[model samples]
Target chain A: MEPIVAYSLVLSAVLFTMGVLAVLARRNPIIMFMGIELMLNAANLAFIAFSRHLDKLDGQVIALIFMAVAAAEVAIGLAIIVSIYRYRRDVDVDAVNVLRG
Target chain B: MNVIELIVFIAAAALALVGAAGMVMSRNPVHSALFLIANFFALAVIFLLLSAPVLAALQVLVYAGAIMVLFLFIIFFFVQPGQKHLYVYSLPWQTFFSGILVIVLICILVLGLYMGGVFTAEEHVQSAAMKVEELTSPQALGSALFSRYLLPFELTSLLLLAAMLGAVVLARKEGRGDMEEKD
Candidate 1:
């Protein structure tokens, strides 16, 4: 049956939407970081789905790489957020302008 | 439909959705971190269903297990104001963009289901890439990872180690020998 794949696509869609909402709705720097992770995860799900659709393992490989990068991003991101908070005593990203272009 | 996979699929989807909701809704940074971990676990289940045993294992080991633990540790040590801090939301355009995106995704999913596509091993990569019984046994995936994809695997692990070191360096206040000492 195609149910599992269908289910997966739907799940991925839901996850993607959730990520969008998180990125849109969060004000805390850490929470925004989490939102970015969610978005990467949604892309990973799509990668797996397309890999299956194409009958190859390549998508899985790409997804694996993405996950690793996501970890690095989050680690570096939280560290930056922490340092910023330490200096300014707040993590409200909207108000910060130290590194903005 | 057999019971277990269906149950797992449903549970995983719910876990992911609720975890995402919690991450967005929680005022406390600690709670957001916790929910993000839960979301990772839910994703591991979805990966398992795709028949990529290696991905599933890594999903749990790397995302839920190691990385999230680091996030929580940082929050515990450094996010003191997380408790009493005020929360802010996204800009108006962001919400509008997200709303439009959700509507498009729903339409796509509905179309996919209505197409009533057939399944075959030779069919485009579709479900056959991970047809649990024949293709995606742990043995099969493990061998593939170690054999064909070995170099990438080694590099990924190396990247992970680098990320850990980076976190330690960034989190600690000192620059060199006094590294462990916090300000």
Candidate 2:
């Protein structure tokens, strides 16, 4: 068995789960953003792993593109957070529950 | 089964996991971002061990070199670090509950292995590192990207361009009334 590769894949899944838990469990906006980043990187790790296992560069290319998308996500997300902060002075997810429709 | 490769793999994995844990645990967004960068570096090192130097190079350049800098800049410049701390969860039980959830998730993962993935061991003749030539050569990657993956490649570039525009528009400094009104 290629234990290393398996372990990395499993770890990637574990981290993705952690990131999911972070998003679900935490109520802070910034913390949620961090969790989302964790999830993105977790998925990226899987991409790299599959790329290596297949002996192809496809996963690497996807991972690069994913990084770009993740960066843009943070940019837009942080901007939204800033705008929210400007009005309420807090990034608490619970407090901003007015749009709870 | 070589001692050196084993040591390297274990070390890279350990560093990555430690930094990952720290990023999740830290309250400071800046610290979390920094720890994530550390985790990214460890992952890139592991990619090197897997003989994907191009992937590893991109991991360092695109992840550590570029994206993280964007994160740090936003956190530092957009928000005042000293402004009163804005903690979200008020109850201590929230943390305790999440901890138990992590434990349960781990159990499920272990059970997943027992259920199937080992059922078949198709002989994989190609060594994990089939050829250093495939991984290291820009020519190989270029042809693959431009030939086999041309459509997806162009699509991804367009997607990135769209994302940049969306990010700028949403994060714009002025005329954020819609957001402010909701806040």
Candidate 2 lDDT over residue span B1-183, tens digit each: 358978988898888887778777777778888888888898888877766677678878887878788778767765576666565447667778887887787778757754646333556656644454677566777788788888877877787777778777766556647676753
Q: What is the lDDT of residue B70 in candidate 1?
A: 74
DockQ, every prediction: 0.47, 0.47
lDDT of 1 at B66: 76
Sorted into a CAPRI-style docking class, model 1 comes out as acceptable
Candidate 2, DockQ score (0 to 1): 0.47
Each candidate's lDDT (Cα)? 0.75, 0.73
Per-prediction TM-score to the true structure, in the order listed: 0.77, 0.83
Cα deviation at A39, candidate 2, in Å, is 1.7
Please list the residue runs of candidate 1 whose C-alpha ends up more than 4 Å from where it truly belongs after superposition. B1-3, B81-134, B154-169, B172-183
How large a fraction of the reference contact set does each model reproduce? 0.45, 0.35
Worst 10 residues of 2 chain A by lDDT: A92-101
